[model samples]
Target: MRQQNHKNTFLKTIPFTSIFVEALKQSSMWVSSNYIDGNSQFQGKLLLKVDSQWESVQLNLHPEKLYRKGVGSDDYTSYCQLQACFLKKFTHFDPTMPNYRYGIRLQFGQQLSHLLCENSDVFKKWFQFLRRFCIMDKFARKYKVLGKIKQCDPVFGQCLFSCVRVQDAEYHVVKVIDKNVITAGQKQNLYRELSNLRKLSQTQICYIVEVFEDEQSVYILYEYYLGIDLRTYIKESQIYQMAEQSSQGLDEKLVADILYGVLQAIQHMHSKGVFHRDIKMENLFIPEKKRLPFVVLGNFCYSETTDSTQYKKCGTPGFVAPEIFRSKNYTSKVDLFSLGIIFYLLVYGKLPFEGKDQEEILRSNEKCDIDFKFEKKICKKISISGMDLLKGLLNKEPIKRLSAAQALNHHWFIKMGTRNQRNQYLQVQRGKSLSTIIENSVDITQSYYQSNSQLYQSTKEDDKLDRVEKEFIKGSLYDKLLYFNSIQYQPSKIRRIQQST
Candidate 1:
């Protein structure tokens, strides 16, 4: 309620209404610019930037280059010199005269242009349009073309594309689902994911912005987060450090921040009856540069609604909770167990359950026999408080495992207030230093997800029949959503790779 109140208060301060914004988008008037040899009324309109992820609306005198590109490819041109495009710092509005009520000057580095909208209403429309364009569109289809975030896109299913809303210039990522490649069952999974994301979006931790679909595709848009996942960050940053014997793993404070973020995400999920069956380092993000301790927890593929039922087997080998393998009735405690694996790895610099192959790893994980090997390096990376929290989360007994809310209040977390500990953080960064790592493209083919081919090859005929029956039910539920007027969907069931009738 407090958060909602705060949001309402913040929004109330905004000047324009939706009607005013719409008027600005459609309204254009004669505009004069103070450019060298520029006409007092140059051929210009309230122009939306032709090619931009950050949809920018400028009073243009002519079609202008965003800035000079240094003989780089078109991709480079799109992103480079974007700072020059936003003239908000140099913009000011005041009435010089009745005829020239709105005066706007835009300065970019050395370049300068002054534009005027003589009429007051038209000028306000332009002003409001300019102010609001920086806000990303509420819809996914509204995002125009931007460079691909990954070096190579996912081959099939949901392909992730990097995008920006031109108006607000806010970075957004789009997950594109090709309807053709997906079976009706696969389509149902998509809808389930969509439903989960929508409910979870209210948490504010979820950056889901919008969803759009047509006959051929479904696009789920999300606010883009810069940092890589905890797994990638540690592998890239610490593997070499470990070789040099300088650091054992992520420092104590760093781990705290990452875990705090994950805890917050999990807490919200649990409150909403969602249990993330797969919570691991790969799913936990590290906000290395961000002072806030809370890192983003994402990837909802294996998460499901936790009702009173024994869950089927799912999730990655090392991270899946032991009770899940038992196939007994369980609750959201499974997520806490998965989170413990992440906690241990961050401190120990290695997975607790290690094996030569995934099968061996699964066996080790099923036993729930964690070998806590203490070393000087581990001591340096974690403290008694940290260790206690890890132990509480990792307890094999579901009843004994710490709930997300309980975990958040643990002394390990309570010693530091959830908010206002930003200064202790290393530096303020949004994954820019690690941006070069984008070139190190992942092999999409050998991805973490269980491929359709692998599943088919491994399953027996009876297993396939069971899968078909389950999918048919899910597909019918998803089809029901299509008949609805909106995307207010409830996931009829959870993702269960193996289940009993």
Candidate 2:
């Protein structure tokens, strides 16, 4: 009977392994190895292991190039095949396939345009590739042309050209492309920009997968971050809401750490004169861990270089700074203001300005009519210092608002009581210079999450910061937001005074 039981367990494990391997083979993303010369289709044996169990799989990827003689060719052939290995285990079966259909998506929308705009030639190639790629449409037909643009002879386009997922610690090549292009020069331009960004972010941001350009459109290759976003993290992951909620809950320090890292990235962009006009919870991506929550400032369609304004009114409603709508001219401070709102959400797990419509939210944002008092009441566990920091950051006046640098240096965050001492701890924690702490912190949460409550208290005093802490410890999603809809959102006195003035 013992032997029979053991054999039964082995038999069950075999089916699980078989399902895993088959799912990998049929997955949209499968790693393709074995380099080749031209457009050739090939498959390679891939090994995947979960926990302690191991399984073998296959990868189907092809090397193709958009070659335009005298113009350019894809710099590397196998560049498109690398997909993240984590996704396969989680989302192996197709939604439309038999039985398995579990998957979550993380996308970089407006940000793609901003990243591609750096090189003109590449941008064109990317545009063409976007138009020419065969993507699935509502009709279930694989069509190359999803839409069209009127720039320089009506260009065609699609939503996304390439899709990738991480399954095991490696990338799987899910899709291959047939060549179509505006030019070879454009193709090379895309490759160069992607390569540069990837290289620069290799250590700073590891989750962003490298992009590749084929004949049709520029394909942004990225691994699926198998977790919820900040918005969901705030709503579902509330400690109190765990049982009643459907989403994951997060910790308080984890929320602050993610916010701090996001501020650091925005600060870096400010240093480079790049303004991510779109800053919101949806734009902030959370990793599987709280400390290493991934907040990417995506949707750069409204982003502006220090010297350009051809693009106008390119931001989401609630998060868009008032100046963008009121003043034609704006700067990186706009992104800073939005970051403040995001910080508020991270700490309080609630939107600063709640209204029934876009006009109301915009009016509130423009008027700076956010009620910290109510936030104070709801977040009874937060510290005063943390609340002060949030108040300063969420200030309506861009000038009055905390710059990313200043926010980082706020007395609230000064645990050791001196800039130098605090800077040292921050550097050690971030693994970079004090100024680059934000960048360093971005990658740490993915691998490390150490709670330092006393350190956090000594550093920053946010009265409501404790609410995030409480939520992290024992709050539930429904409990954290139980009052969100019922509570009346009123503007603070300072905001009223400013408006009156």
**Candidates' lDDT values, in order?**
0.51, 0.41
Candidate 2 on 27-75: residue-level lDDT in tens? Answer: 3332233344432233333233324332333323332221111113323
Positional deviation of residue 414's Cα in model 2 after best superposition, in angstroms: 2.6
Candidate 1 lands at a TM-score of 0.53
lDDT leader: 1
- Those runs of model 1 whose alpha carbons end farther than 4 Å from true positions after fitting are 1-141, 151-158, 202-204, 239-250, 286-294, 308-310, 379-381, 416-501
- Best candidate, TM-score: 1
TM-score for each of the candidates:
0.53, 0.45
lDDT tens string, model 1, 1-501?
Answer: 654664343223222222112222322222222232221112234322223221223322211222212222222122111111222211222244335434443333233334456466766654443322122223444577576554222224327787877777777777776756766555545544544554564332545665544445556676676467656765676653664365434456657766777787888888767787777766655443553354576777666776558656788889988888887676888888988888887666678888999999999989978755445344254544456577778878787677887776554443343343222221232232222211121111122112212211222222323343323222333342342213211112111211221
Worst 10 residues of 1 by lDDT: 489-498
**Candidate 2 TM-score over all chains jointly:** 0.45
